[model samples]
Target: MSGWTAHLPVLPVVLPLIAGAAIVLIDDGKRPLRALLAVLATLAQLGVALWLAGIAGGLLHSPWGSEIGVYAAGNWAAPFGIVLVVDRLSALLLVLTAALGLMTLLYSLARWDRAGVNFLPLFQFLLMGLNGAFLTGDLFNLFVFFEVLLAASYGLLLHGSGAARVRAGLHYIAVNLVASLLFLLGAALIYGVTGTLNLADIARKLPALTGADRSLFDIGAVLLGIVFLVKAAAWPLNFWLTPAYSSAAAPVAGVFALMTKVGVYALLRMGTLFEPGGRPPLFGGDWLFYGGLATIATGAAGMLAAQQLGRLAGHAVIVSSGTLLAAIGLLGNQYTPSMLLYLCSSVLATGAFFMLIEMVERNRSYGADLLAVSFEAFGLADPDDPTGPDDVVGIAIPAAMAFLGLSFVMCALLITGLPPLSGFVAKFGLIAAALEGAAGLTPVGSWVLIAALLLSGLAGLIALTRNGIRVFWSNARSTPRLQVAEAGPVAALLLLCVALAALAGPAMDYLQGTAATLHAPERYINAVLQAEGVGR
Candidate 1:
């Protein structure tokens, strides 16, 4: 833990930061080099992240019985300087972010990256911000990283230029800008009362507050919680998600799948940090539970009502968010292991779905989607229609339609939590864990979640089946032009999910250890505070 790999914890952030800046200075015309640099940086991040995950896991089970790696930025210690801590949860997310980013970048090389200047740079910067967000141990730095993330995302969202993308990008920016203000206000308020922004220090300081200080802190925490919910795309604040994600180019939308989880990660981390002070979670109790239920209901309803493939995938993101939030909100029964497994499963499936939708959408005509939508409101020669591109050279040999059909089926099964896939395994784990709980949560609470999850899955099944039939079977159309770059990433993402299923037992074991550590956070606090500063 003390050798060269001590730097592993920080490499995820530094690699991307350096690569993004370097790429910016290069000529935009140097596409190959710029792309190569970006891909190398992301692959490096994936390597570092996996190594750190191994270290964290091994350390957790070693005689040392700890899984924390704290890298004091600028060699400065906690409470006084920036810190990056890699534990089970952060390391897990770090790996997830890098893997997903690599896939998105690969998909973009098919041409989305060429649609605009600085695409690779913005992509790298986005990765930097996401990695930094997962690694940072302080709220102020989290805000900085969040801003960096949003700035880059704004560019990525509007990368291809259409009225739909522009409109969605505007709304997306507006929402996050407001969320950012709330974030700063909340962080400032917490710092004012706690005299510290470092997570470990805040956890240590939260106890022993009197009346007004506690009241103000509580208000700030709620403000912060609202911001997180927005990022998580919870309920009323989530309207922007469907539009923004559905409107963005394929690769951009694929990467955006991980963005919502940032909010969930913050909530889980902070809940652990703050709970030991004998305080209820900022968003706990029946209200949180019911709010999550409403979110699930809304998401399922959207899925059922979706006309376009992009919107369906977007709604699927909402469903995943709702499930995780509801599990977290189940006051006494926290299904941590199951939730973590579900997190990995859902993110992979949704990201792949986003990318796949673009290719599937490409093969058919606009009227096809419009008529599909006409089930509520709303053409092979229609392919010659100017709006519906006819010039796309279809992939020869083993026909692109065959690939699309297989991929679409895989996505549908995964998103719907059907059997023999990681999604089914994850959903089963959730229900089983809830049932096996100590009965701390009320019966009503447990049953509500179980029902929502099952019903939501049902809704997903119906919607996806309808869409699949409409898109693949109902019409005769030219198959999409596929590239190895585009197809490879989607296939890889799905295979990871398949791997999760095949290795469910081991995956759950790891998650169980992670959950146990999360429930017991004293080690996390002590490790960060005791970490040495430079010249110490």
Candidate 2:
């Protein structure tokens, strides 16, 4: 690679930042122009992401080799200057983020973009933040990117301006604000002890710390872990997730699915980077194990009890987070590849589910009235649906409802890890890996995880079945006319999941390579620290 291509590592971040700033200057009245610009920028981002992934996978190569790409800001050296590092893991996630952004942006063009000012600009900024967070090689920049995305999310959450949205947005903002404070405190403590903000430098320094310094560093690390868990929506700290996500507009909620994985990415990075090598195990292994199980239970219960499709989708996010966290706790290299595959499938399905919720709920009054009449027959009148017109016979469901129903069923299978889909492939791989002693899980722990996986899948199945019945089978007043913009994205997302299932072998190979790189952090650290004067 030569010239601009050499800077691919940073381009993912910079391109979006520049585009976002440019978009902010565009006249709000020029919606068509602004939308066009946003789509073009996101398309460019997707191209960059695919290019970087290709390089990381050795399908393409540069002077820096196939494993990693490093770009030092302003040609500065490591441990002193800002740097962006891209490896297989980061590249995969960047692609996921860009892909989702493009799809959601396209869907927003149907209507949601008009719901608020600066939607395109805010979206561009959100992408910039996500890419930066994934690529940044230091703690400080990570925090900066976190704030960037959070700020964008705040606006997106309140984009349509409803009482429920505002209430949920406030709660979301408050929780994240506290997480940000903890992030700062933890970063400061780590910097004080390690004398560097760079992730590679901190890893290099950690093995040498002694006495009270190590203890303090450990405390800081724990604080950082807590913050990440909150973002990951772990049990006891995840109450705000369902309400906030469910209240947001469809496009915004769809893209927000990636936000929780950012937390998982941080934990994976830190855990692999800072492992003590030959020392005793650190603090979070058991915490992740038990906490993940608890989260799974909570999410399962929430999904089973959820009356609204939106809330059910929110709980589905929790279930995905819990699964990944639990897998991390198992500490098996064999499981990591399968876990990565599962992560990809889950994120895709969940995002599609959120988008589908809007389409499905548009005609909910029909089923709701049916529900009300049934209750009245049982001598209990529903105040919310008081004495409406009697149900009309021969009401036909719309083609849109058929589309929504099919998509919802697919989402259900994907989320529940049922057979013949990518979800089952992922779950089976995980279970097989665990039972084979790939992660060295204790007998009890293995059984516990296996049971959790099965039970969670069962709960998801039950909840989605009920939701599908109510939404698609019950009589509705009228069928919603599906817009091409809305239906196209949802179809594309579900098709991608199908393709994932069909191409499981190659996808697993790529993910396995990513998992290997993550477990061996030296390759990453060397790639960043060795950049020196390259790409300047």
Per-residue lDDT tens digits for candidate 1, residues 364-472, read 6442322232222201223334564343222333678888889899988888898899999988977886776534467776777789999999999999999999988
The list of candidate 1 runs beyond 4 A from truth reads 59-66, 331-334, 365-397, 437-440, 534-536
Which pairs clash inside model 1? 374-378
Candidate 2 pairs with clashing backbones: 332-439, 366-476
* Model 1 CA RMSD to the hidden true structure, in angstroms: 4.9
**Root-mean-square deviation of Cα positions for candidate 2 versus the true structure, in angstroms:** 6.5
Q: Give one digit per residue, the lDDT tens place, for model 2 in 6-113.
A: 778888888888888988998887878888999999999999999999988989866465578877888898978998888889999999999889999998887677
CA lDDT, candidate 1, residue 104: 88
List residue ranges in candidate 2 displaced over 4 A.
Answer: 277-284, 365-398
Of candidate 1, the 10-residue stretch with the lowest lDDT total is 371-380
* TM-score attained by model 1: 0.92
Deviation (Å) of 90 in candidate 1: 0.5
